[model samples]
Target: MLSVHTSPLHQPGTGDAGGMNVYMVQLSRALAELGVEVDLFTRCRGEARPRWADLGPGIRLRHLEAGPRAPLPKEDMPALVVPFSLALLKEERRYDLVHSHYWLSGQAGRIAAVGWRVPLVHTAHTLARVKNAALADGDTPEPPSRIRGEHQVVGSADRLIANSGDEARALRELYGADAGRTEIVRPGVDLRTFVPGRGRAAARAALGLPVDAFVPLYAGRIQPLKGPDVMVRAVAELLREAPELRRRTIVPVVGGNSGAGPRGDAWELARELGVSDVLRHFPPVPPAELARWYRAADVLMVPSRSESFGLVALEAQACGTPVLASAVGGLPTAVRDGLTGMLVHGNDPVEYARWLRWFAEHPQAGAVMGRAAVGHARSMSWQTAAARTLDVYRDVLCAERSGPGMNEAGATARSCLADASLLEGREGRNSTLAALLS
Candidate 1:
């Protein structure tokens, strides 16, 4: 697995990290349980750390030195593609298939797959074309370079993995991706970690939140696309409409700022909208602790202008917390409207504010929705998602073994993957991984 630009080791809901980090970490662990060895490679951005480390029983994180040991903007990544691809080439020989997480890695993965004669699978966590179409206020449109890069990756990859049917359709319509190679694999949530019935009272006490407050939680990277400012504006609107609830209401916006959000900033927006008195800002917490926050919430607010998939909505639902999300991208699929949560259309603060007011008034209806949410979340799990993903990998490998897909170098890739399934009990050091780490 390639995750260039951002590392899975980084905390989600901060900086350049978000759902993709969680997706890679949770999916890798789930895949490991199914007896698949996963070596996730990303650009090294820190000093004093080894190039590779065993994350767990079957998962390893390998950092390749492609540039300076510091974070770089997404725009600067294009220049590092050759160096990143060269770094990947050193270890590409040992991999059966290359699965890249984002467009930056797709640049490297495409080169490595060709050099190693392995199948390449690319998952664009967010597409430039899709995002540019729904730019938030004071947000810049995605550059033409990124759109071109995505087109190249879409055309070059053996398989294009989309997190939702919505994403699959976008791939076809926006990038002209081959329908035959497109696969829809829903991103999974950690069921065991985000279990239901943690109790709202207990959660509030543990998290130091007001016990009587009607708390609406906004959790994720506080970016314009994520609409944290929209969340703030909605909270202000709700408070203004119902001043009586102001003393008993709290809007906890949890996450670090990024992109246009860093410039138009949520904290500044909250103050400008006169919601600072009722709003609480906190850094992103760990997953286990985040589940507690979800439990304590009257509802989770996802006002994202664009989302490829709504991982947090599922997470909040898994914690028996109803969500009020913008009906854009995968939010419609993540939330079962009138069942688990309410899906508001457009990026309007007024609509979201109306829903928040409704939840505050109808406590019984909110509880009923929360219970239904838990039931829906139970039916989806990381294990199930991993199993389905493994099926995709196996199908590709099997197709290659039988079909006339191999041409000289393809024979080597076929042999490597066909025998990999038999390596469940085996363990060894790969020279490339060892050298890079050392």
Candidate 2:
């Protein structure tokens, strides 16, 4: 079985709990269920010492200390990779393949693969081009060096795993990755946790919201990239056009925290628009609480300009809630227009207001769409995603070992063993490491 490393597996309060964290946790658990021995490596935060969680008989989460013992932002964690990789390589275990998530992990995976002579597979959840295009207003500043590093990782990876067809196309167009080297594998959601049920009253009661109110949900991180500002403006516009909506006790429940972003300013904007009474912003809730929010809401809104795969849309759909998302990035792949949900054109306030009003007047249509949304959600699961990822690993391994005069695979295995020998005398060597070291 292939061993994967998805370092920096999100702190509980971080805004990156959307797709990357969801993918890592669910995919690892699903792979284990398929009889694959999976070891998930992540950074140890604060006093949260390195510990192992036995997710299943075949899966184990091995926390590795990287950078500071405390949590660091994603953009600032690349320098910690060299030391982290060195520590990981010193361990005595031979993996058939090493799969990395995101560019930071890709860099470590590539170095580890070379040193260990294992095939490396990379999944860049979001590309530099998409991020830059979405955050072009100087609201979010990403380092130029990080962008260059991401480009290098994409070009050098043995195989690139794109989350959607659109992402695969972007890779081919922007990074010049060979079409043969790229594969499209959509992300999966946990249907069990996000299923439809009697959650509206329970969720609203817990949040101290009126049960009779019509709620519109915007779950995930609160940031400019997410375009919460646009959603606020749209809600303000909707209330202005139809005073009945305000009288009907309509509210926009935004789930997530500020997290060093424009969340404070977003609140200020809501006040400026005089829609503060209707905008209910709160810190992110647990998945169980989120499920209730999904059921409690009349609609889910995703106005993000860039998203590799919108997991929130899938989650909302699974809860039988219709969505209204931006027609950008992987959102188009996630939300079907007029089927699972409506697709608004841009971040324009007027356009969003129009859609909100239409849905308000056409409740029956929204309910029908929500039913279709649930059916659509059933087809996407973490088990399916894990199976697809395993196929990619198999294909890459086969290609690496195929053809005459290609002793590269054999040579690489020998080199990995040779490297393991140097750490034989190290303390605290486990059976897995000792056997490989010998």
Per candidate, the number of residue pairs that clash is: 0, 0
lDDT of 2 by residue, 150-210 (tens): 7766766778899899899989988887788788888888898998886557767776778
TM-score of each model, in listed order: 0.91, 0.88
lDDT scores in order: 0.83, 0.74
Best by TM-score: 1
Model 1's TM-score against the true structure: 0.91
Give lDDT tens digits, candidate 1, residues 346-405: 888999999999999998899899999998988878899899999888876766566654
Q: Which residue ranges in model 1 land beyond 4 Å of their true spot?
A: 259-263, 403-438
